[model samples]
Target chain A: MSARDTILARVRDAALARPEAATNREAQVAERMTVGPKGIIPHQGQATGPQKLRQFLEKLEANDTTVTRVSSEDEIAHAVARELRKRNLPAAIRMGEDPMFHAQDWGSLDVSRGPGRLEEPVTLSRAQFAIAETGTLVLTSGPDNPVTLTFLGETHFVVLRTEDLRSGFEDMWGDFRKRGLDPRTVNMVSGPSRSADIGQVLQLGAHGPVALHLFMVG
Target chain B: MSGHVPTSSAFKSNSQEALVNRNLQAALRGSRGNFIAKRAAARANVPEFDDIRDQARDMKNHVLANLDLYLEAYEKKVTEAGGHVHWAETAEDARRIVLDICRKSNAKTVNKGKTMISEECGINDHLAENGIKPVETDLGEYIIQLRGEIPSHIIAPAVHVTVPEIEEAFRKHHAHLPPDRDLSELASLQAEARSELRAKYFEAEVGITGANMLIAETGQSVIVTNEGNGDLSQSLPKVHIVMASLEKIVPTLEDSATLLRLLARSATGQEMSVYTTFSSGPKRSEDPDGPEEYHVVLLDNGRSNMIGTEFEEMLRCIRCGACMNHCPVYQSVGGHAYGWVYPGPMGAVLTPSLIGVEEGGQLPNASTFCGRCEAVCPMRIPLPKMMRSWREREFEKNLTPSATRYGLGVWAWAAQRPWAYRLAARIANRSLGITGKSKFSKLPLAGGWTKFRDFPAPQGGTFMDQWKAGKR
Candidate 1:
C-alpha cells in the first residue's frame, strides 16, 4: 500500500479495535413518511445551465412568482419592489457604498442597500449564483454585498439570470479559481429559512426567511 | 440553568434527585428525536459522509502531530500578517491576558460569541465579577446568559428551555415593553434581541469570539454561524480576541474547506450556513473595515496530555455537537445535569481529563455504555472505552465507594471459582424467579437501574447448567 493507504489503514485499525458503544438500541422500525422531493419542472435536453434556469423561472412564473429580465442592477431594483408588494411582505432593500449596487437608481422602492437595519426585511443585490442540479442559489460576500443580506430578511428574492446556474459547487469554485476571484464566503439558498428549535415542531421564518421567491430572468 | 451549579457538597447529595426530576423524561424524549433524525438526513444526502469525516479527522491529526512546527510557523506568519498570538498555559493566564488587553484598550464592556473554552474557564463570570460586562452576542447564548442560567446544550444552549419560559424571561427583562400583549410573536422577540444586541455591538469596546477552525498556513481563524453575530463581534470592536483550543488548527484553506463542508451538514444539516467567515489578523492597510487589533489566544487546558495516548484521537473533535446530539444520556438530562460546562458523551470523556476526575469524579460512570455517541462521532472518539478508562482511573485512585469495591471484589472472588459462582447464580435466579414474579419488582442493590424501576430478573438457569441438562 502507498503512504496514504498506510496511514488510513492504521487509523481504520485503531477505530475498529475500539469497544462498541451500547446505547438503547431497542428499535422496531416505523415507516418513514416523506414524499420524494418534487422534482424541478421540464427539460433542457442538450442546453447548458442557462437554459435550465430559464425553464425554472418560467415554472416559478407559472406558480404566480414573476420575473423581470434585466441587463443591469436597475431592473433588479424595480423587480424586487414589484415582487415584495405582490407577496404582501414589505421591502426594505439596503444599498451600500459599492459602485456596482449604488449605480442603480432603485426606482422608488422602499430601500436601504447598505448594512441591514434591525427588525426590517431587506433585498440587497447579489453578485452571482452557483446553482445546483436542484434549484439551489449560491451567493457569496465581497465589497458589493456582504453576508447579512441572506440572513436578515424574512423573505429573500434573488435576481440572477438563467445562465448563471452553473453545474454545482465544485464546478463553480473551479471557475471562480480560474477567474482569480478569491471568494471568501459562499452561501447557498435552497428553500426558505427554517428551524425546529422548539419541541421538534417545524417553525418557518425562525430567524430568516419563511418565503424565498427566486426571480430568475434571462 | 440551575440558579448556579450547586456547591460540590450540595451537588453530591442532590445528584439522584436532579437526575429524577419531573421534567427529565420530557427533556430526554425531545432531545433524542431531533439529533437522531438530523444525523440520519445528513448521512443520507452525503453517502461519502464517513469518508469525508475520516479524511478531515486525519487532516486534523496530521496537523497536530507536527503541531509545534505548525504553531511556530503560525506565530511567524501571524506576526508577518500584523496579528498577535498569545499562549495561555492556564485559565487564569488566559483570563489575565484578555483582561489586560481589554484594560489597555480602555474597554468597559465586551460582546462575546459562544466559546466553550471561555465557558470552560468561566470567563463571563470572571469578567462580570471584575465589573466588565461581557454580553453573549449569539441569540441562544444571549437568552440563556440573561436568565443567569448555564447552557443546557452545546450547539443550542437553550434547547431545553420552552418558548413560554423565554417569554417570561423577556417580559421581565424587556422592561420598556407593554406587559399585557399576546406573546405569540417570535419574530418580535428576535427583533427585540437584535435591537438590544445591536446597541451592545455598537457600544462595546472589545469583542471575543471562538474560532471553529484555525488555518495554520495563513494564520487566520474561521467561524461558521447563521445568526451573523460572529462577524459583528469580530468587526465592531476595536480589539478582537479569538479564543480557541490548540486542537482547532488545520493545515490549509483546502483542508478547511473539506472540514467546513462536513461541519454544517453534520451540525444542522445546512448545505452551508448563512455565514462561513474567515478573518486574518487585523484590517489591512487598504481595507476600511474590521478590528484594529487582532489577538489569537491558543489554550491547552489539559489537551496536550492526549496528544500521544489512546485518547489522542479525542483531540480530533471538531465541536460539531453531533455526538452529544445523539447521546442518550445527554438527551435525557440535558446539559445542566452533567453538572459541568461540557455535557454529553464527549464531555463525559473530556471533562475528566481537564478538571481532575477527583474534583468532578463520577461523571465517567454516567453513561449506560450506549454506543450511539461513538457511532455518530465524526472523529470516531472511542467515548465508551475512554469513559471506561476514566472509571478505571477512579477505581485505581480509590475514588469509588467502599461498598462498590467490596461487592465487586466479592463477585470477582466468586467468579474465579466457577462452580461456586454458578451455584450462586442459580440461587439468585431462583429467588428472583420467586420474588420478581414476572420481573425484578424491587432490586435491593444497583444505584442506576433501581432508582427508576426494577431490573428484569435473569433467566431461571445458568447457561452451563442448561447446556449440560440439554446434552444429557
Candidate 2:
C-alpha cells in the first residue's frame, strides 16, 4: 500500500460509496492524509532592489511608500507619468523595440497600452527593476515591441532598475545569454489579474492584471 | 459558432451550490495573485527545488508503477510512428472516441488547441451539442471564446478579463466593418480572430490538441506554446485528436528534457515557452507539413485510482500555475472559485477526488494553511498536507460547522486539559480584552473569523502569558 495509501484508499472507497453524498466535510478529508510536505514561502531572503521593489509597490500603494533613487529609462518614464497622475488613470506607453533595451539608460518606459481580454484593466512596462529573489521580470520582446504592449494591461506598470536586479533564475538567465534577448515573449508579472474559474470564486481582472505597479530606478 | 462557455452541469448539479457562490468570490480573487507569486518565483529558482520535488516524485512513482508496461510501450511507439493509439475508460468513452473520429473524418469544423483533456470531456459542449463548429483557437482561448466566458487562467486562459474589458469584448464581438478601432490594434484583433478563425483552419476535417508531455520513450506528444496554435492545430488538420490524461506520461527524450527544463521555468517566468512542440508520429514518410490522420486519445479520467495513493502526490502535477500561482486561497478566490475542472492548489486536491468527495468535497476547506503551495511545486505537491487531508475528511464526516462542531468540540475537550486549556484561554483572553475595545473587529461565534479579514488583538499576554512573563 502506498502511491500515497493507493491515493487514500481510492478516497476512502469514494467516501464510503456516498453516505448522504460524502460531506462530514469529504469523510473529515478521508481520514486526514499526509505524505512528504514542504513546498514554498521563503524568498524573504531579501534582494528586492529597483529601489527595494519600488518601496514595496509604494508601500503596497498609498502607505508611507518612500524611495529616493533615479538613473533613467527616461527617468523611469517620468516616474510612470508621476504615478498615473496620482490615480486618474489613462495611458498606453509601449517601447522595448530592442537595441538591447536601447543599450541601457533611457531604454524607454511610458507604458499604458492594454488588453489580453479577461475583462480589461491595463498597465504594460516590463522593466526598470526586477528580482525580489525570483518574481523575476526584465522583458525585451521586440519588433518596436507589440506583444500586447506587455501582456494586455490591468494596472501592470513595471520599470525596475537597482542596476536591473537579477540575483536568481540563473541570475536573469545570464542576462538572457549576455544580451541576445528578444526570443520574443518575457512577461514576469508577480501579482494581480486572476481567476479561480467560478466555484472557487476569488476573481480579480480574470484573464490578466488586477494590480502589479512597480517603478524602481537607481 | 459554439464559442465554448459550457462547464455547468453546475460541477454536474450543485456541487454544494457550486462551492458556496458569490461568483466563486469573483473566481477566488483572480486565483490568489498568480499562485502566490508563481510559488514564490518557483521557490527562489531551485534551492534544490525541494530536492527536485523528491526526484520528480520518483519520476511520477516510476511512471505510475509501470502503467500496463508504460501503456504497452506507449502503444508500441504510436504504431511505430505512423500514429493512432486510442483508449478511453470514460467522459463517455472520451466523447464517443472524439465523436467517432469526427464522424469518420467528414467533420464540419474544429480549431481548438488548449486541451485540458478537452476541458475534461465536455468537448465544446459535446461538439456544439453535436452540430459541430467548435472554434477556441487559443489567444487566451480566443478572448474567453468571444466573451461567453470560463477558462479564467491555468497558464493564462484569459487571466480574468481586463483591457477596457478587452475593448468592450472587441466592440461587442467585432461588429464587422471597423470604425476608428485601434485598441493597440493587436494585428486588428489578430486580423479579426484570423478572418473568423481562418475558416476553422481550412474547413477543418479535424484538429484538436492537449498533450504537454506524453513520450514513454517514443509515442511523442508534447505541446508548450506561445501560439503557432499547437502548430496550426496539428498541421492544418485532416484529423489529429491527442487529448491525454494518464498523468501525461514520461520516460525519455532524456526524460522529456528533464520535464522541459522544469516546464518553461515553472510556467511563464520563462526560459523557453514560445512553441515547444516534439510531435513525433503522423507525418513521416518524407513528411512535408503533416497530419493525414493521427489519433492518440488515452483518458483514464480518475487516473487509475491515483496508482497507490497519499492522494498519489497529486499525480506529480505539472499544471504549474505554481499552486494557483502561490495561493493566498488562490489569490483571493479565482479559477471560477474552484467549482471544478481543476483550479488552484491543483483544484483543491483534484476536485475532491475527481468530482465526488461527496460531489466536489468543499474543495479541501478553501485553505489558509498556506505553505505557499508546497514551496512552489515544480512537482513538490504537498499543498498544506493536502489541505490537512481535506480538514481530515471535513472532521470525520459530520461535515463540521455547527459553529465548527461547537468550536472543534470545545477545543477538542479543552485540548485534553493543559489546566482546562489554559483556563479557557485565560478566561477567553480576559473576556476578549474587556469586550474587545482592544478590537478584534467583533466576535462571539467568531463572525466567521472577523468576516473577510483582520483578526489580530491577542498579544496583551499568552504563549502562557509570554511563557510565565519570561520564566519569572
Candidate 3:
C-alpha cells in the first residue's frame, strides 16, 4: 500500500481503538471545519472604540514598532519621506503597484514599483487589516503588496488606515472572509524581526527589517 | 552527519557531564529565568490565558481523535490549492521524499528555516550526503550547525554554547571576512550573520521549513517565527517544502487562532510572534514572486501508535519549550543531557514513546516529578503522570537497571505488607538516628546521594509510631 494509505489506516485503527472514537468522528470533523467554532476570546481582544486604538498603539510600542498617525491619506508620502529622512535612510523605496500608493505623488523620494530586490534599503506595503489585539498587520501576497517587501527590506514601512483596524483575530478573520480574498500567503507581522539566539539576549533586525514604522492614517 | 543516534540510554552519564560543564552551566544560567519571568508577565496580562489553554487542549483532543478524517480533509484542500502532500511513515521515508523533490529541482544548495521535524528526520544530513548543501537560516540553528552538533534546546538550539564559543565558530567558518573585524558586540555578530545569510537566501533552489499548524480548512501550513527567515526561505526558493508531522493538523483557521493565542505566549512570552505566515500552495499566477512548487511532507514515524496508548496526550504538544524552561532538572542538566532531538519534561515522556522504552527509557527516569511542567503546559499534558507510566513500562519490560529493579521489587514487596513495611520503616528510622549527628557526611548504599550533599539523620521514631503515641 502507498504510505498515505498505510499511515491513514494505522491512524484510523488507533483512533477507533478508543471507545470514545466509536462515535461519528467523520461528521464531527466535518462540522468543526464548517462551523469553525471560536474559542475563549481574551477580554483584551474585545476592546472597542478609543480603548481598542489605545491598546493597539500601546502594543505596537511595546513590540518596538514605531507608529505615526497621519490625518489624511495624502499625507502618507510626506510621512514616509519624513521617517526616511529622520532615520537617515536613502530617499529610495521599493514597493508594488498598489493603486493607493500610485495615487499619491511621492515628491522627492525614489518610489519604484515591482517586487523586492536583493538589497532593499526601504520598502513600503499597504496592510489589508490591522489587529488591535496583538498589534499585528495582515498583508496578503499579491501584485498590490508583494510579500517579498515584507521580509526583504532593511526597514519596512506599512500603511494602515484607522478604519481598517479590527479588535482582534476573530473580527479580522471575519472581515477577511467577507472580502472573499484568497491570497497564496497571509503574512501577519507584529513587530520588527528579532532573535535572541546569541547569548539569549534579544536583538532586533535579525533578517527582516531592523526598524518597522507604521503610517497610521485616520 | 547521519541521523542523530539516540544516546538517551546514557542519560545518566550525559547529565553527569552536563552538570559539570561550566560553559553549558553559564549559558543555562543566563537563559534560565528569562523565559519563566516573561511567560508569567504575558500570562498576567491576559486574564483568560488559562481558559484559552483549556480550550486549546480540548480542541487538540478532538482533532487527535478524528485525525484520520482531518488529514484527508487537509490533503484535499492542499491538492485543490495546487500543492502536493506526501505521507511518510518513517524518518527514512521522509528523507527520501524530501531528496526526490530536491533532486528534481536540481538543488545544489537548500536554505532551511527552523523545523524541529526536519531535525527529527535528519533532513540536513540526508541532503548533505546527496551532494546538496543545506544552510540553516535560523541564527541558533546556524550556530549549532557550525559547531557540527545537533540542537540542544529546541527554541534556543545553541543554548549550551557560550558567547566566546560563538565567536570562535564564526571566526573559523567565516574566514572570508577581515580577520581583525570587531566581533565583540552582540549587534556586530547579528549584523555579520545577517549579511552572511542574506546572500545565501537568493541562491537556494529549495527551501524547507517546519509547519506550526496545518489548517485543514484552508490547507495552509502556518509558521510562527520571530525571525523572517522562514518567510524568505519559502518565498525566494523555487520549491518550498514543509516538513510537518501528522499531529500538526488543526480543523480550521479558527482552531489555529486558538493555538496561536497560546503558542507565542507559552514559548517566548510574546503576544504574537513577529511573523505568523500562513502559506497554502504555490504562488498564485498573478503573484510577483514566491515558490513555484510547494510540497508538504506529513511524517508519522511513531505518532500513529501513540494515538491509542497511554502516551496519547504527548501528541498535544505544540513544541512550546515552556515545560523545559520551568523544569528544575532540565534547568540543571541542560538540553543536551536528554541526548535526543527533544529534551526536558515533554521529552522525558515523548522520547520513550518515540524511540521505545528500551533505548529512551532513561529520559523518563530523569525527572523529579515536580509537576511544574504540567502546570505551565498550555496543553496541560499530564507530563509527570506520563513519565511515571513510562517508568512502569520500563520496569515491566525489564529495561530498567538491575539495581533499580531490585530496589523497586523490595519496595513493592514491603509496600504490600503493613507489618513488614512498619518494621522496615522503624528499623530504618532507628538506624539513621543512631548516627548521632544531625546529618551524615557519607551514607552506606546511598553514596550517589551523599556525594552531592549530606543526608539528614532521622530525628525521631517512625510516622506510624509517632501517630500511635498521639504526636500526629
How much of the real interface does each model capture, measured as fnat?
A: 0.08, 0.01, 0.88
- Candidate 1 residues lying further than 4 Å off, grouped into runs, are A1-74, A87-92, A97-99, A102-105, A109-120, A128-143, A146-218, B1-15, B185-188, B285-288, B434-436, B446-448, B457-459
For candidate 3, chain B by itself scores a TM value of: 0.98
Docking quality tier of candidate 3? high
Instruction: Residues B3-120, candidate 3: write the lDDT tens digits.
Output: 8899999999999998889999999999989999999999899989888989999999988998999999999999999999999999999999999999999999999999999999
**Chain B TM-score, candidates in order:** 0.93, 0.38, 0.98
Write model 2 residue lDDT over A2-101, tens digit each, in one string.
Answer: 2323433453454344423334542322222111122322243234555446434432333111233566555665666666666566544444344434
Identify the CAPRI category of the predicted complex in candidate 2: incorrect
- B217-253: candidate 2 lDDT, tens digit per residue: 5577877665445556666677788888767887654
lDDT by candidate, in order shown: 0.66, 0.58, 0.92
| Candidates in descending DockQ order | 3, 1, 2
Error of 1 at A1 (Å): 43
TM-score for the A chain of candidate 3: 0.96
**Candidate No. with top DockQ:** 3
Q: Which residue window of length 10 is worst by lDDT in model 3 chain B?
A: B349-358
> For every candidate, how close is chain A to the native chain A in TM-score?
0.63, 0.25, 0.96
